[model samples]
Target chain A: MMKSRPIAATLAFVAAAGLLLSGCSAPAGAEAGGEKKLTFMFRGGEDEKKAYEKAVEQFEKDNSVDVDIIVTTADQYATKLKAAIAGKEVPDVFYISPGDVQAYVQNGIVKDITQYVENSDTIDLDNIWEYGVDSYRYDGKRVGEGAIYALPKDVGPFSFGYNKTMLEKAGIPLPDKDKPYTFDEFVAAAKKLTADTNGDGTLDQWGTGLNVQWNLQPFVWSNGGDWLNEDRTKVTVDTPEFAESLQWFADLQNVHGVTPSVAEAQTLDTYQRWMKGEIGFFPIAPWDLSTYQKLGFDWDVIPYPAGETGKSATWTGTLGIAVAESSKFPEDAAKLVEYLTANKEAQQSLVDAGIQIPNLKDMAEAWAADTSTKPANKAEFLEIVKDYGRELPAGNTFNAEWYDELFTNIQPVLDGKQSAKDYLKEAQPRMQEFLDSANQQAGN
Target chain B: MTTTMRRSRLHRKEHQAALVFVAIPVIGFLLFTLFPLIFSVYASFTNWNGISAPVFKGLDNYTKMFGDRYFLKSLWNTLYMMIGIPVGLVISLALALAMNRKMRGTTFFRTVYYLPVISSIAAVAILWQWAFNGDFGLINQGLSLIGIGGPNWLQDTATVKPALIIMAVWKGLGYSMLLYLAALQSVPRYLYEAAALDGATAWQQFRHITVPMVRPVTFFLIVTSIIGGSQIFVEINIMTPTGGPEFESATIVWYIWQKAFDNLQMGYASAMSVVLGLLVFTITFIQFRLNRRNQFSID
Candidate 1:
């Protein structure tokens, strides 16, 4: 009986200890047998998952290390990643969005890979687009100026996806794919393309749709306006140029009645409407190519319409692969990041899957020339990236919050409940306050 | 001496067995519930961003709530949603009373009513969203058939709260009805018979006898409903991504989730959670006192 009691007590203690330690134990992929293991995490759709799985398999076979690839959906990625970081179960390598890079770097959750990149024999830093690389660079105070913390997976430039069938049905000439339309010309074309085909009092079809928050950069930037100055220490959105551009964008839906109302858009949403051949033009990116290929209607790509400045501009959505600072094998993780990003063969597989554009400057031309792809104006994507693509203001810390705040307040302006001038006048100071605090925190 | 030693050993063995049974729950309570509660309370007084070490900020997080428009709006929205509790109780009790009588297919009807309670919140919210959609929703189509133009139920700020409240009441009706059904079954049949002999109508008997008999159950449902209503998050999150057009449908718990997870403002979120906890506690306490006073008055 005495022997049994001690054994039972010891078993209970061990069980309790196991329960507690399981949470904080080594990574699930850590050092199986003699092979060192790497935990890689990313978020994407099924196509991206398949592409990444192939790449990981190749990487594992060549490197003699076991790689555990964790894939999450886009919606749950941020929350899951944050929870993982807080719980100290951070993946050795992960995909970081431009908006989150600053926060991750500021918290020292991501390792600085500048030294690793410089020391690598296979990677040529200059071969990648500077803006794409700059999105992940942080110098403690500002982005675009210091140590590279991540490698760019893709540089996606937002452009116009126009319904060729709809334009032809309206007997309207297609806008030049190489040279974008002037603002007035675009508006006129949109008005001509819009119609109420069923003879109902309500308009059944719209010329274009804009996701006020995501698609605002084209108008703001082409009109020679910006959210922040070069240093990102001040808010530049209060200028007359910005307000006028914003007012013009809102007028397309309100005064012009070319775009669907907020409530009407909720019925089918812009993407669905575009797929149904209802919208004349909608924002498109490289990642959307796979989905767009399934559309039955004739469609083509075009540059964003130019503003008074006669310049076309849009935001680039860049995804970067970063190494976790908590990783024990930072060098091995760096090697994996390099293989996934800098290796042309690895990128070509993803590119062939229509999930990404080539990150290498020279390779993009060849990739664009491949006639097997959809959106016949594929060359225009490269032109926009090379000529006019700008990083979203979200690349800066706290700027995303201010950007969201602006969108939240500007709804009234778009609904025609308030004027843009009055709204911007009231909003500029609040935005500046956010920028000031962020700047101070960044030691600017 | 040998017998005494054997008795002591048996007692020790029984005591050990009792401890083994108790230890599992004690460890769970400490590790899962108690630890998080204490840690969250501490987190409320700091400025932790989930990634960095928390900096002690004393009363700053608490004071900041006063100036936060979103926080105040969420609190008001939460209280506004509690309107569903009373309305839900009345409807459920009426159904319960009707079903408690000699009725055909009582089990079938009860199962039908309880289906929504068993269904996942995500599924319910998605179904309700489709029904409440502005343009192509079922509700608007029905209204149009009646020559009435339905307002945008989910999009417009003015109508969003009522739409959410209607959903909450519908979702809660089944659970509340089951509780009332059980309570009504327990009421003495003699009381109703005696009342009927006194020529009391069905309404009078229900008002005077059944209501009083079910008061304690009613109190239980009310307290739990209030607590549940105040923490409404999933429905609003699924139905309205931006908190229903300018934060109109934002509940306190939803706001806390956004702050903690979305904005990484864990400390501020924790502070708001503490406040919500206190609010629930105070309300429950007052409810208990009121119920006690009512019982005394009845006596």
Candidate 2:
């Protein structure tokens, strides 16, 4: 009996120790058995996932080390990335949106690639847009000084994409592609589009549908109302301009009864609505053109309407490949990042897939010329991005939740349950407090 | 001395195997549960963003929690869900008794009613989201047909939580029903016959015999449902991304998620979780006490 007790206790101790060792083992980069394998994480649907996989396959063939690719859905990306980073098991290479770059960079998760960029023969940092580079930089340090966290691979430029057939059917003159109608004229056009064709009590078609997501930020920016001040430490959304623009937005639902309430817009697929020729004008990213083509509507791109600020501005989402600081082979990972962004073939492949605006300066025109692009005025689409586009602001707290806040806070105002003034007034202080608390917690 | 030693040896030998069998799970529970519970209790007293190292800040999170509007709203919402558990219990028990009869296709009917409980919460939440859509939803349409206008079911503040309650009850009723059905069928048939022969009506037979026989099962349902209902999260999370129009449908778990992820206030979130756990524990304890006291009378 004594002999068995000792044996059993020893076995139990061994089992417990085994579990603990498994839990605390070194992450992927450490204790390698072969040519170090680096993980690249991204989020996309099947098509984009396929493109990324193809790029990774090519990268693996060129490098001695194996490249592992992990793809997450858009909704799960932020949550998973946060957990992975916190666990200190982050992928060696990953995709980070420009808005989230600051958060990751500030937290010391990403390695700066400045030194690598300086040494690389293939990638010309100068050719990359200064504005685009600025989006990824923090306090004058380009993402991780001497090591780039990521290189810009795709640029999602926001612009107005209109249904030419819908405009023609409604007998509304198409706005100039080069000069979009003024903000007032834009509203008038929308009002005309809201009219019922069947003369039934219900309107079968609406003038336009606005996405309650990130799309509304452009409208706020157009009115010269910023969500936060330049320092990003204070919220500045309760100003007269913000209130007026929101009032205009609300009028579409409440007084003018032209567009659906923000909540109703949530129900409708904004891209699908524009594609089906049910809506005349839609604010969308150029990346959406591929999906828009499936509807086969006679559509074209237009510059953002000139707001009271007079400068036409559109919000942009930038995508890039970043290297984790804890990477096994930092040099190889850096090279791969550079190759994915700057390699002519890879950039052409991305453009060919109609995924996004490739970073190379000359690749801008090729974005429109890729054989896969079926838009009637593809050049005009690229032109809109080149001529008038502003990258989205970056900060430590910039995330999907920011837009969710805007949507939820402004929803009642849009529904006429409250005035825009009252809503924005309440919202500004609340958002400010949220950001302040976040800043305090982050020790900014 | 020899006989006592022999008995001790035998006892130790018998329990050693049982000890070996339980050792892995016990260690796992201690490490994953007990250790974290202790660590989080320590963390709850600190100001932690989860990125940097946590700094000790005694009682600050708890103090801040008192003024948090969303936290209070979620507490009230949790209390409100307590009402649904009893409503769920009565309906489920009634259905169980009906289904316990020797009817044709009884198994098929049971499967149909219990299906929602087995389905993924995400799918059910999504299905309900569409059904609860303010304007074009089937529920609203049905209401309009019956000359009763549906208040914007998911959009309005007052109606949103009630809409979630209806969904929760619908989702939960099946499991309790299955439990009660088992209890009903297990009751001896001779007891009902004896009561009937003694001039008992159907109602009296049910009141005197079936009710007593199912008292234990009813007690089980009440306890499990209360515990399950208090921790309800997936429906509110999946359907109402922004906590159901002004945070009306925000439950305790949903509030914990918002605090941890959205705000990155892990310290505050941990404090809230401790309070919620205690709240559930206390409520369940009181319920069990009351249920045991009433068990004999009901039977």
Candidate 3:
């Protein structure tokens, strides 16, 4: 009887713990509102949230549909989205980066919105930038060939922002509007601009600052070296053009000593240094316009320098809005996406706030020509978009894996520990194997 | 007969009440812990991308680990970080002994030592990242003042692990010290007195009495510390956003997290997690056996 008493107590404790835990695992469901509710998830900061909130409010009033918005930090967005998908609670409309669009589409999480786009009387597919529209198109074998699954939020063109004051102080002429500096000219200008302002042995100002992963695209693409073959079936990182571009980029830090060392860069990040007018040329996107407006020095942007091919090349960063396949109200979600991406008012609101470039081709020219905007030469962004811009290798399903591998392995080469040729040579076969496997898995 | 029946009825009521009390927790355990564990084990054998249905892949996921350089490197990094555990234990024991004495401000000292344990890991990692910065950092500035050039603690491959270990040890010291203090306080004074009566010195008494008496506490500390140390994630994630300069600080859990969440390779991550679980289990089992053998020897 005593043993029974202890057993009963143990059972009570276990039962209490189990009940509490079960409560924790209770399934999350959408609120049962009288009006049709649409859930939208996005990655952004406070500014983005504010812009989205205003747009969503307008959307709700016009359509009489309720929107449940979920905003998460950029780092947490992917994990949260995956969890939502796994739990069968995916948002009706969600932001999908170009890098993730292929995988999401392949996994059957994104709905094909081609028919919706064609049927919608309000949406003119021709008004949107081809790059933005094509970013979401994915055939079984490659991108830019199949059904459109999403609409781009913006066309983020990477251009070079230079401190005009620094150029004037160095007695160097500003780069020509149409013809920016060639690779040699850019390097020479950078060398001349590099200075030791405090007369200390150490340099207080640098020629430029660039992230190997984010800013290297211009150099690689300008050199006519790409991450994948034309059809995206294989990795092509072992070519001489790719190796030479990587080496030249690294030499800007190691051999030329123009840029700050990795250790020095860690102490004060390049963004802060750029704000302090310490860098001569730094990569800037349209989104960074507001931040740069606060900088005390005179600054203007130019297209990325011409490389060995004598052609300026750049990459466009695109984030698209897609309807989830599991959405109960996919039609409504598609309408929300159309309103967010195709509506002139919504695009203008984002552009006027310096949040993003216009997704519509017609609006981009006017937005860039707004002289009241900072960077005085905002038109260069449009030039890059219309002429030299291409989507990142991540546009393909398996290409992001290859891209990440390069970024991971290229650190040694950038640090001058290994030659670019040797490193890429070693990594090429492994990358090819990975891409082959990904293709096989996709039955391509 | 009526009294016996009354007692039986009361016992029956008590039993029912107890069953009702425990039912919630048992159901919770079955739903959250047990179910997820079983699902994850099953998932380890499949190729699930979290969004799509899992497809059985037999031992493919497990076999991939044998050739995965990053996985092997992360395992090494995890074991490297465990070096901090024993070092932390010794430092905490020493501090606990000193603070356990009947001195003025003992409580204040105890509180000060326990502060890090209560503090948030994200805040601590960010603070330490600045302190460990190669240039314009407090640590480097101090080192330069003493005629020593500090290496780039977080960026350099050679020093990144040591930097992480130092941070881990510092963060863990408070909790370890409090545990040791509790164990120290419970040690009977009679054993020490007997040792003193035997003409033993202070060190001799401490060695003979305090050390042996704290064996069980030490065993508990080592087991828990090893488990916790192997799962180091937050500190590395915040301090080294790219997994350190050359993947120097990538631990097994961090790798699993990256694979599962960042790359969407949930099944592969589950397989790696299962392997990690086995590794931790083996180490803990060996420690338990060693502890038991030591106890038997003492008897």
Candidate 4:
């Protein structure tokens, strides 16, 4: 018995460690390894994965190189990517964000690709959204000034969508396509539509169900309030206009009764309510199109309700296709990025999969002009993308800690426990500290 | 003389084999655990952004932790959730006492209690998240039967910690109970009989005999529970992705993780992690120091 005990114990431990090591390495599979191999990591849903798989297959065939696709869910992608980078198994090309450009450039994690784009005959710089392209431009001192580190994957305009059936049922006129509703008019409509449809002594339908994080930008911007000033050095969210806009957003749920309460929202969130035709309005991004296409209710897009400025405004978001600086084949990776971002076929496939609007202006215009889709006002998304859709304030800053601070304590305002003015007054200085630290970190 | 010489040689061979066996795990421990521990200490004093080279920052990251509201709040939240440890132990010990009896269907009840322990924490967290939904949740529906409206468990700042505590206690009850059960079985029956023979009242005999018998298990459970409680993260991330309502549910680890990956503040996170490691080590050291006087060393 003693003779075999050591072997058995050692074997058991080896087996256990083998399991752990194998499990850890399992997700990092390189399919059909070859001399010319490239790894592309990106985050999205099943439809997006399917779409990318097809596009990647075409790119591989065209380039005569092996491409390994690593698809991760949205929530876990950032963590997984960071782990990969830290572990020194960095993917050749991955989705990057503008907000991370300064730090990424400083770290040499991403390669500068200004020369590749300038030399490529297939890519027309003007065809891509200028703002989207500029978001990835980092000059070491500023984000949007110098050489490019990544190419825009897609410039997604966060559009406002409303339920047509609910509006019609409430005898409310449909929102105009070109013009936005004034805050008062929007509230009036919301109040009109928020009634107990089945007379169960409970609210089953609400005019709007907006999550503050994703939906408050339009109101704040339209009210002539912004998170940062022109140079992006100072936080300027403590203004009276910002407070008034924030108060109005809070009043939608607390005082106006237009939105679902915190308790009410905990059951079926605002997004679910919108899908079920219970909510009048919700924010819609291009990435949401595939999932939202399956919604039971008929919905259409509109500009968000205007505030004090009488102008519609909202944020545009984008993910950049970045080539890793440590890649064995950076030029190949850069070519793949160029193809993904600028190629007509790849952009069309992504759009056809309902994941995004086309990157090319000509294709986007043609796609928006088509009226057969569920959202008849596709032109509104186009208009926002083409004209007034501004980058989120976080995109301009060195880091988003300062941007994220604004919402950390703002729940009290939404809960009616704190006033917007007092909250903003306290918030700006705290944000400034993070901003200052971030600025210092960036050596600004 | 030949047999003796052969036996001694065999002994030497066995000793070498034993050393080899011990060395495998020792090497792994040193490489993975010891190396990381030492590296993190060095990293805590530097402005390492996890991408580029690190710059030395002296005590900046460490000193900054005190003034960070998020860090303080998260630390408080982590400690607040540790309330579950004591509550879990008490209930589990009581359960162990009850289950020690020759009862019907004891195995089934044991399995039922332990099911949560074996289940994946991610799945359990997701299930609890659904159950704690304010309006149409199982918890609120149960409360409605009693005509008492339950506040939104995971969303409301007042209840998020309590909700997490309740879940932690529930999930961990069976493991501690199992340990206590084992300890109870191992206790000699003679002590109880001797106590009863001395004309001791039921309460006194039970208290003196049973409680003393189970002291080792209690010590063990408390130390481990505190260590586990302080590092709580996965549930907070799963249930409240934005760090709960007003950041009430965010634990120290979750905040560290957010700062590291989300904010790209790896230096700050590494410093926080060092503090957490030291705190956990100190607490564990204190427990060991106190327990050194007690009987039944873990080794």
Using TM-score as the measure, the top candidate is 1
Give model 2's TM-score versus the native structure: 0.89
Q: Go through the candidates in order and give each one's C-alpha lDDT.
A: 0.84, 0.74, 0.83, 0.87
Root-mean-square deviation (CA) per prediction: 2.9, 3.8, 3.8, 3.6
Looking at model 4, residue A389 earns an lDDT score of 95
TM-score of 1: 0.93
| lDDT of candidate 3 over A281-397, digit per residue (tens) | 998888888677788999988878877887888888888999999787788899999999989888778876777888887787777677786877878777777778888776656
lDDT of 3: 0.83
The better candidate by TM-score, 1 or 2, is 1
Error of 2 at B207 (Å): 3.6
TM for every model, in the order presented, reads: 0.93, 0.89, 0.92, 0.92
lDDT of 1 by residue, A1-444 (tens): 663686487568758776677845566456557677889989998888988899888888988878888889786787888888988889999998777777788888999999999999758998888878888888876677799999988889888879999899899998888788998898999999888988988787888988777777888899998998876777888889899898998899888888876644353467778888889989888988888889988898898998878888998888899999988788889999998897878888898898778888889888787777688888888887777888877666643556656865666787788888899988988788766755553442
Taking the candidates in order, what DockQ does each have? 0.42, 0.36, 0.39, 0.47
Question: What shift in Å separates residue A49 of candidate 2 from its native position after superposition?
Answer: 2.2
The C-alpha stretches of model 3 lying farther than 4 A from their native spots are A1-34, A262-268, B1-7, B102-106, B296-299
| Regions of model 1 farther than 4 Å from truth | A1-17, A20-34, A265-268, B1-7, B101-106, B295-299
Candidate 2 docking DockQ:
0.36
Q: Compared with the true structure, what per-residue lDDT tens digits does model 2 show for residues A1-444? A: 555766567677777688677755457656446667777788888878887678778878877668777789876776777778767788788887665665566677888887888899878987765545555665533332233556776667777767788788889988876665777898788888886678887676777777545555666677787677766678777899878777877776777766653356454445455666677777756577567667767777777676677666776667778888878788888888888888887776776676666677777665566655555556654554465566654333544343345565565776788988888887776677777765554444
Q: Please write out the lDDT profile of model 2 over residues B1-299, one tens digit for every residue.
A: 99999889778776776676677689779988999898778878987655546789999989998998779988898779668888888899889988988789889989988999999998999999889876567898899998987766777778888898899889988998998888888888888888888899999988888887888888887788778888888888878777877777888898887777665677888888888888889988998888777766324
B50-144: candidate 3 lDDT, tens digit per residue: 76789999999999999999899999999998999999999999999999998999899888889999999999999999899886678989999
Candidate 2: segments with Cα more than 4 A from true spot: A1-26, A99-103, A140-148, A261-263, A267-272, A369-372, A377-388, A391-406, B1-17, B141-152, B296-299
